[model samples]
Target: MKDIKDINKATVKNKTVPTTTGGGVKKVIYTLSTIQRIGLRNSAKALTSHNACKACGLGMGGQRGGMTNELDEFPSVCNKSIQAQSTDIQPAIPNALFNKHPLLDFQELSGQEIEHLGRLGTPIYKAKDSQHYCEVSWQEALDRIAKAMRKTPAQRSFFYSSGRSSNEAGFVLQLLARMYGTNNINNCSYYCHQATGVALTNTIGSGTATVSLEDLNGCDVLFLIGANPASNHPRFIHKLKALRERGGKVIVINPAKEPGLVRFAVPKSAKSLLFGGTEIASLYIQPSIGSDIALFKGIAKAIIEMEAITEDFIHEHTKGYDNFLTNINATEWQEIVECSGISREQIGDIAKIYAESSNTIFAWGMGITHHTHGVENVEYISNLALLRGMVGRPGAGLLPLRGHSNVQGIGTIGVKPVLPQDVFDGIEKNFNITLPSEKGMDTLACLEAAYDNSIDFALLMGGNLYAASPDQQWTKKAMDNINFKVFLTTTLNQGHVNGMDNSEALVLPVTARDEEWQATTQESMFNYVRLSDGGIKRLDHVRPESVILTHIAEQVLPDSQLDFSAFRTHNNIREAIASTIPGMEKLAEIGTSKEEFHISGRLVHDYNFNTQDGQASFITHSILRDEREKPLPYTLTTVRSEGQFNTIVYEQKDSYRDTDDRWSILMNPATIEKLGITENSCINVRSAHGVMNDVKVFPFDLPNSNIMAYFPEANILVGRDHDPRSLTPAFKSVNVDIEVVERQPSLSTS
Candidate 1:
């Protein structure tokens, strides 16, 4: 085993490849033929898995395939493959990590190793040089976690959960955290679509998608905004295909160029699989990052001028149309075109398609949510739907295609820093306790607390918070200041590897979504409540998060008012959740079944709302733009490679740009030239707290002026003070000047 010092010195090769010409891209797009589509489908239909290396021609097995080192190499190779697939090119190293995991100390990685690590992460702390990590028992780990959270000023403690938890475990975790006195529940939704949920609920009186499966063929237009369902949520592609079959027009807008928006292969559909995938988006528009607000604002302006607004619907169900129209009228067309980077004719064409349609469905992803002005963009998207009465219709509504399967469901169950007014009262009344009054901590808040020494402890339910947050050093230092930290994960990551300052900080490994959770789980789309039948037992060493929380609660709050032990059975937690949240009332009775109960909203289609006066309230949004524009040469928006999810480096390959996970900040060629940076220049991305040096440069046609830095890496540049609205840590947009720097010495070969 290598010593921590020696391992820290392990060098990685983070290299760059040559760029291709624009003409080659044009030839592929200009010559789309009927027979080519047929052949493509046939090739897709014949796709299957293999056991050998798909890229480097490496074999999988025996001496080299030894489990010990092989486990560490897997995520690196996965990241490499995913990068290649998304970018349409290959990496210099052929494959990242050769099959190693993504956990690493970035600062010391060699050029070769950095290629596989994907993002820049350096493990600041390790238990020992030889052991690398000391596996603590489940009990010892959770006990330490519970103690830390209890010592914190309850208000400073943060609880970050993931979508992989079973409902039984999710409810218990949330209930226990809240009972301990803080609503600082930060889930993946804060980054994905808290804006969509909050905005949709305010405008339509419902936060969920109003359209059901039956409504797929009921729409005239399927607008794909800020979402890529083909690779992210492939299960929902049938709906889009069905709409096209019914003569519907589709529209898409995103910063990165994805093959999915242009095409998709349905692994499940026989016809779709046999016939090559159907064209999902009829028109594709690659808009600049953080420009969604202006783009949608342009659409709304056109709708109003063309008299596309449904006057009858507005007069009967809305409150702020006149004020909204006034703001729309105030906008200049040229400003919208310049800001959104969309031609007037294109905007007019989208407006015409929308006007011609009787029903339209709008769905978005993180592209619309990561900006400082994310909330405003979501509201603007909702405003477009409301102008034509699309909110509650069968085929027209807002669906923020969330990442992580049940990210929405977990929020539905019990993951919130600040519970809604009703749930807050219900929990207090039900538990016979008055919860703490201070505004609970959120993601950025927790980071600030860690840095300021306000929080003595932090609890991570099921996320890589340290790696996912902006300004990696800010969060890293914040954790160091804290008395203790807890990470609940399936594999080692930058958090456990680097964030821990005290040996008191512990890491607890658990099961993933594909395995039996020993409890019930939920998905936003199917099987609202899925009961785990104990399909295949995981190694005894691993346990569900719910079980961990229960034991910890028992040990820490031994005599608390609530019977924390009841959580041993996931069903008990579900029943408890059902009692307070009306949506889950039948969860205990329904158990697990093939049938997934659609979240019921009686007023959704009826147009009756729960707001004051039973009508939807609208906020007349004045278009707000990103004020910080220091990285003026280009605008960058980080879009995930098709093979990865969130911060999990399942693959090192990015197919779209034909690259690997080397923590490279991709920019537009024009922006790079304007800034006097070479194509493969090494630049230091300087921000408020510090600088991340030795990051490679790859120029592409993403958002001009904005540089789209990949997650876990770019997040390192975001400051703790950035995420003001939802405390999401402005991961989407950051104001920073790029300075070209000389490359650091190689750690591997040296």
Candidate 2:
């Protein structure tokens, strides 16, 4: 095994002059290394068995429950699946270790070290005055939690969830929150895809993907905007490969110019892996960060000038075409170029490609959502698609590629502040309980409420809320204000240590999804639902989240209208889900039939929409301007490294970007030279939120006035700036001032 010193030295060699696009030899090597790190023998089942990849929302796996993809081919897993499953299946950390390392000791360790501490073995507790956490019995833990929760009113308590959970678990947990007479239930989506849901629903009558997985295969053109599927969603590369092989065109639009999207070596095909990778983008467009709306509107204007509009389709299936055209014509060419950072001719060329393609799919990621005008970005993209008749067709529509494995499913199960009236009616009639009618708070609202001491209790199903949130200092302070914060998760994260202001904290260990005693369900970005037969428990004391939530509900709400005991059975939860949730009627039968299904009423293959008028709407929106009091030299956008998933750092190195140091920021080489900042120079990065000193600077291909930094770490510089409509934090367009600082001397004594 290589020593840590050797690994650190190797980082210099590993650093690429320009980052490799996505999957290739490095991904394969990293995958094997992680598998070896966790012991290949121990992870054999997780890799070879039938299960869903917990990495992204692409929904890859054996269609019928084995480790294969929906195509039912064996060994269809990717590097991400291996890394995530291996890390999860590692041996539990013994209770003695917690005693050996006090709370302060654990707090002093780095994120990488803390991640290497292994799985949480047992339930633990920290009292109001205790300096260290002590192991506790399940009964005692539940009793204490029930007592703390009982003291707080339902309106003052909130429930937060991550996309990692199963549909059964999310539904039951949210139901518990609503049954407690409070609608203050929300999921982590408020931080990521909330804009996508809100915008798509306004335009197409549905918030999710209109096209199915099969639609992607048949599409002739794909506008893969904002998202970087190579590092973030590796399995998605396979789809791009298939699309290219079928003579399709993929136009990638992202500011960073990711290597994988430019060209990729997919391991699925040995030929492609052994030689050079398959080409991904036929055309790549890089607009200034948060300028997607301007770029898209420019394309719309060009399409109109070229007379490529699908007039018949627009007239028959759309509304507000005249007003949309008027707005496009009224907009000046110079304003578009200035805001979009692309030439009018270039925009016309892109429009020409779309004009000719018979079928095209419009897709995007957080780059489009994490902005003040995020809703407008989505609207502009929809406008372009509507002009070209791209939506509700056989091989084309809108797809907001989600990040979490089951986040969309969580929303479908009603994990939001407000529930649809019909769904609420179903729940009330079936469960014999009157849910709270008052307005509920979202993730940001919850934090603000906590800061004001209006919220007394907080329950988290999964996700590192503290680290994942923007403005690290504010988030920590807000979290600390809650009287009691309960986190039910599989392992320890930074949130456990710093993300609380609560007088008391509780950490309840939960089993991984593949280890649950009962089967569960997860929804893919494509709306297909898969069943996971979970029977591989790694720890003895750890319990499934459903079991924990049920027990907690039983203890906290003994006199409630529903029977908490009935929820112990996963089947009962699914039955309730199928009967109450719209378009999910098949869930009730999943347990018995063992059939993988797709939720109805989502895939809009025809012109018939779910909207009131059964027609799509065209929305006009205004462009954003620089409103900063002191304009910074560069805008810093926080991104995820290739080494891990959301907030979970499996490896400190970002192999794709070729940076081993997580504290490093990527910038243009010319800009670095112009500023007289040499390579490896430490710098102080300041934003409205906070300041991060000693951040390493490196050369990379970014826009002239833009730079990139790793998320969670750089989340400190992110503030409460968000889209007014969706409340999703504007993480991609943060204005920051950077100044070179003296480089720190190495502390190593070799």
Please name the candidate that would achieve the greatest lDDT relative to the true structure. 2
Give residue 257's error in model 2 in angstroms: 1.2
- In candidate 2, where is summed lDDT lowest over 10 consecutive residues? 1-10
lDDT of 2 by residue, 1-750 (tens): 111111111222223255464677767887788788878776786665556678788887633544566666555667778767866876777787766655667766666667667788888988877766789999998999899888989999999899999888898889889888788999989999899889888998888998887788878889999888887888777888888989988998888877788888997688778777889998888888777878888888899999999998899999988999988899898888988788988888788888889999988899889888788888878888889888887899998889988999999999999888899999988888788899998999999998898998889998889889999999889887888889998878888888542368899999888888888889999998988877886788889889999999999899987898898899999999988999999988888787887789999888988899988988986566752222777888899887778888867877666676998888876667666666688898999889988988877667777889998899999989889999999988899988778643432224
For all predicted structures, in order, the TM-scores are: 0.79, 0.95
**lDDT tens readout by residue for model 1, 245-322:** 778888988776555566554443456555655677787887777777778888988888899888888899888878
On the 0 to 100 scale, the lDDT of residue 73 in model 2 is 51
> RMSD of model 1, in Å?
10.5
Indicate which candidate wins on TM-score.
2
Instruction: Name the regions of candidate 1 deviating beyond 4 angstroms.
Output: 1-132, 142-156, 265-278, 513-517, 525-527, 592-595, 625-632, 672-694, 721-723, 740-750
Cand. 2 TM to true fold: 0.95
TM-score of 1: 0.79
